[model samples]
Target chain A: MENHERSIRLPDNGNKVKAMQQKLLGVAVIAIIFVAWFIAARIISKPLVLPDFVETMQQFFKGWVDSRTMSNLGITLKRVLTGSAYAVLVGTVIGLLMGYSTKVMMAVSPIVNSIRQIPIMAWVPLSIIWFGLGEGPTVFLIFMSAVFPLIINTVSGVTGIDPNYINAARSMGAGTVAIYRDVIIPGTLPSFLTGLRLAVGSGWMSVICAEFIATSKGFGFLMIEAQERMQTSKLYALMIMSAIVGFVIDQLIRLLEKRLTSWRFKNGKAVG
Target chain B: MARLSVDGVTKVFEEKGKEPHVVLENLRFDIEEGQFISLLGPSGCGKTTLLTMMGGFQAPTSGKILLDGVPVEGPSSERGYVFQNYALFPWMTVEKNVAYGMKFSSMSAKEKQEKLKRLIEIAHLQGHEKKYPIQLSGGMQQRAAVARALAGQPKVLLLDEPLGAVDFQMRELMQNELEHMVREAKITVVMVTHDVSESVFLSDRVIVLSSNKGRVVADVPIDLPRPRDRSSEEFDKYVFKLTNLVRRAFQERTDTTF
Candidate 1:
């Protein structure tokens, strides 16, 4: 009974207040971190190590569009989104294969294990050699890094479906294809979203690494150029913006996760 | 009328290098049309296995089952199975869960909608159409499972511990409600349950199984009226006889402490 109470959906006004407070809390934390950085940079650190936060902000707003920061940011976002799309599509197919067929799993397991053993960084030099230093290598790295989580998570999701649902669907005269299409796919979505969460982070990491190593554009490229030119303020600006981009992406994914999995949180505990 | 005949059914499990274990040995039973038959036994007596075989999820090692003179093949909409845990699609609302069977149904969309509405009402879940099974109470989940199972208007409904997860008072109420639903649908039911009072209260006939080799020990008939009183003398008599039968079966098995 107490659990039933705890599981009650927040009223409209209550929800508004909660959302507002959560946003405020998030901003306040970031502001405090900025203040601490301002004091530290002002007092102890060299300008090269940590630039003035206020100066970085002023330069960031002034030359934001001039330095191609926004454009580079757009390019990086595009690369990550496209690579993730391909990763999810291909990864879902591979996961379904591994999940449904033992023969496919046996044949693919060794190759997947071998690839996973190689570091994501190791793929940088190899990709540049194979595809040349352009979007090819950058996209390839992101795809490779993003796909492992997608494949592994999708496999777990598909294979982990409750047998009872399958049986129930089958008993209802649903054919094999229909069962997989309707029951298996939707039932496995929560688990797949968890994979998407991990994939986005890894995919972002790969794009940045590729940009820093070989690419002449995107956020990583901007940061590298700033470092080489001793533009500490620009580097700080890039760093702050980069963190914000990752944070916003993560927050969006989290909101999606919560939405897709409202079935789980409808009650205080996951009765299903 | 739906007549189900289970004839000389045997199920044996063969493990690697171990002696084969026979779960059921030439078990035979008959369930008449519209009868509520409860397969009652102590734990591990293969009552659930028997129920699953009836549902065509599992096949017998020997012999066959016939439904209205047709040999039972693979799973079909003609027979509905309700698991103890409800087996509801967690991602779906109660309305969708109840409406799921229509995807395979030959009925028109209008007909399906009417049936969905009626079943939801019969399950007493009028306001809960938007709620997921996880959000419901245990008894409510069982009702939703019943609603889903009855959506297709199957010849029979197989329930494996339909009320097992519900609280005690709720269990009694749900059992009565379930019997009412079954009667209203006029569907044959083969239910597996261990609760003696549950077996007595809900079934038109209760078939008790002994543990050693899954075999029916006794088949008791209840000619009691609708809404049979649990505190009544006749109900207590049935409970008493079944309790002793279960105890005797348990005593025969030296491994069991019950």
Candidate 2:
């Protein structure tokens, strides 16, 4: 009887072990891929084209340790922050105006529609002509790329707010400013954060492209210079660095989004 | 003073290319201070429309809504409205949601906290002060909504089917809580409800309304003692009479040709 009871409990323990094993299997697969790539690099005749993982990692560390590379990365981040700030400010204001008034919505909708159709890449030539080279053109491109999505999303956010909330506030004797501040702003924050995430991704793409074409600093410039000099290894290194930076920024935004939306998932997950 | 008086209130809703629909026609009523009055009717009876007009969220096409003998031209801090959907701001914590209208008041933070504590206690939401609306159950959210409206200390409180969305057991419980809150606060309450038993259980007087050109048809008074027993013979008699009145109103409307 005791043996039978142990047999029954064994399946539950087995399932727990199975779940842990699956996680370990995932890590093992990633490790295998890296090992395979490293072995292939040694076997290949054109070793420069497919540099060993060890060399690439060393270069990555070197780039990080060098003050010049760090400063260039810092400059790129600064541009993104400044461009995103301006975009969020202008976009949110315009969105609020359009959302609240039917007349303004009708008048401005066509203009926003036309502007939205123009690709971020297509604006590079005009941005360069308008603002010239250096940080200005690159930042302008990033701003132009980010602002439309932010505005559209913000307008949608404002429109999606429950009319009952507005009615409740109004009946409570809240003035216009109070309603907008207390009800409208908090109501739209989730959608606004979503827009902010999308803007960051788009802004990064535009800024990199602008940098590749015109600027002297940043990862994009370094990648282009490496390509011109036929340094594939350096080019790949810069590409990897850019990927890391993009991923880090995306993760940071996701963390913020989770924090903001935690109120909705009170029982499901612990708030970060 | 009479808490509110609607003088020949009429409301017409205009639709493009269609004839205007008259919701309320020469409907007049008065609510005395500290009285619990319920506007009971079928759906589309314009009871909610009348409530909104009284709250100053909308204006009657032709008529006047007076509060405390003063003509109500627009919404003021004196009137508090509770929505059927329990329109508590989802982003705010329960305490902050209750504190929302108080932000506009010149009361200091300490005074606001004291008032918030009182309202929370009255609504039986003492422990869930930090929770968001989404975290609370439907009954809890409604209770928090009640706390929010009472926080402003308005002259009159309007409830638009406050218990409509709750389950039957919770609805009964909420009915008792609502009645207790009204009695304790001594605030004028004008609630709209479709449930006949709920009206009888809570109201001092129930106003029955007819729909489709919605007008007040019957003004029934419930003289039962406080803490009404639903299973009692007197309660059964009142329920039967109110049911007959509603049935007659429906049949009368159906008999009319388009």
Candidate 3:
């Protein structure tokens, strides 16, 4: 019996050790990627095509303190925030309507699905014609890119709510408005948060594409300028900066999701 | 007048291009005020459909359900329901969930608070008030559901397999808690369950339904005293009889289909 007990204990310790090993393996993968990039850069031996890893690293550190880089980052952040905020608000309202009423869903889903199928770049010409150049067109593109994902996810979220919750609310004398406020809204929150995350990620990418093609004043434009002047290392640095900012924003949103939907993560197991 | 009455209740499911299927046909029963009744049957016997209809979650196809001589038009606080899965709002704390049913009630602030406190005490969920439903055990979640249902001071309580989710040991404990809570509240109850032993132990009367068309099969009164002994021969006899009835009903359904 004692030996059997000891054998059962072994796997519990093994699981912890296995988890630690996985973390180390992730770090090792990052190290290997950096080493491979350095080696490939040496073989190419052309800074214009692929700058040396050390040179790019130096430029990357320098870009952090560069006022020009900082301003471009701020511009991009503003556009993403503005577009995504509007998307979240409108998406939630329409999604709730669609989920609650089959008539609205039947009417709206066809148009929404067709519009979403069109690629973001395909709308650039139309956006420019409607809004002119600079911030207007770029922001419009971002909005168009972000809103559809939010709408789709929000609709699914609302439709996915357990019918029991609605019945329970009704049994407690909750009317249509009260049910929307108490049962439908809170129930759809987890899915809405997921939609927000996806929306932001896509919005960030759309803003860059929009700036590259239609605007003169954001991070994407800055990258284009660096490329034209053959400042290869600086261009690499700008790309890295864009990636780091996107990573940070994604992380913050994830943190916000954790904070807002704390109920989902309680008890060390997700209940709903 | 009866506290609740089902007048020729029938339910039909109509699917596109398919025949209209009758799940329950002319189910008629009356529940007296402050009596504990259980709707017992095999699976797919429409016991839950009957319970949902009683709670006004669904309307019958061709008949009406009346509560105190008034037909149930829709769901209202007068008929509180407890679901099998204990549908407590995951976002809210236990106290908030319990207070939810009374949000629009006419009770004054003080009375509501006092009732809330008493309910928490009754459900034995004092320390767990601030915890979310996801953080609770199966039994505690069920208790929280009952507390929420009772918060409205409902005239009748409708339960749909209230103990179905709990483990065997926990089921017995929750059954006792449920009986105690119902007695204290003095509310009429209509519980739907497939467990014969459970119905015999907690109900004043058990109305068994046949599986094929959800027709009434048996109406047996327990006639036993309070805090009934589950291990007693009398209790076992009731269990055995109901179990056989439920089994035969299920067999009839299978035999016809095959």
| Candidate that would win on DockQ | 1
Q: Count the backbone clashes (under 3 Å) in each candidate.
A: 0, 0, 0
Per-candidate interface DockQ score: 0.60, 0.46, 0.55
TM accuracy, model 1: 0.93
Q: Is candidate 2 or candidate 3 better by lDDT?
A: 3
Instruction: Give each candidate's fraction of reference contacts reproduced.
Output: 0.71, 0.64, 0.73
lDDT of 3 by residue, A93-152 (tens): 888899889999999989998989999999999999999888888888878888887888
- Stretches of candidate 1 off by over 4 Å are A1-32, A62-67, A267-272, B255-258
Candidate 2 backbone collisions, by pair: none
User: Residue-wise lDDT of candidate 2 within B1-258, one digit each (tens)?
Assistant: 678998999999999999988888998888888888999887878999998888888899998999988888777668888999999998888888888867677788999989988988988887778888887778778888887887788899899999999999789988988888888888889999999999999998999888756777899989999899999999999889888877766665677624
Interface RMSD of each: 3.4, 2.4, 3.3
Better of 1 and 3 by TM-score: 3
Clash list (residue pairs), candidate 1 = none
- DockQ score, prediction 1: 0.60
For candidate 3, write residues B1-258 as lDDT tens digits: 999999999999999999988999988889999999999999999999888988888889989899999999889999999998989998888998999979889999999999999999999999888888977778789889999999998999999999997889889989999998899888999999988999998999999998888988889999889899999999999999999888888887888779
Q: How accurate is candidate 3 locally (lDDT)?
A: 0.89
Model 2 earns a TM-score of 0.90
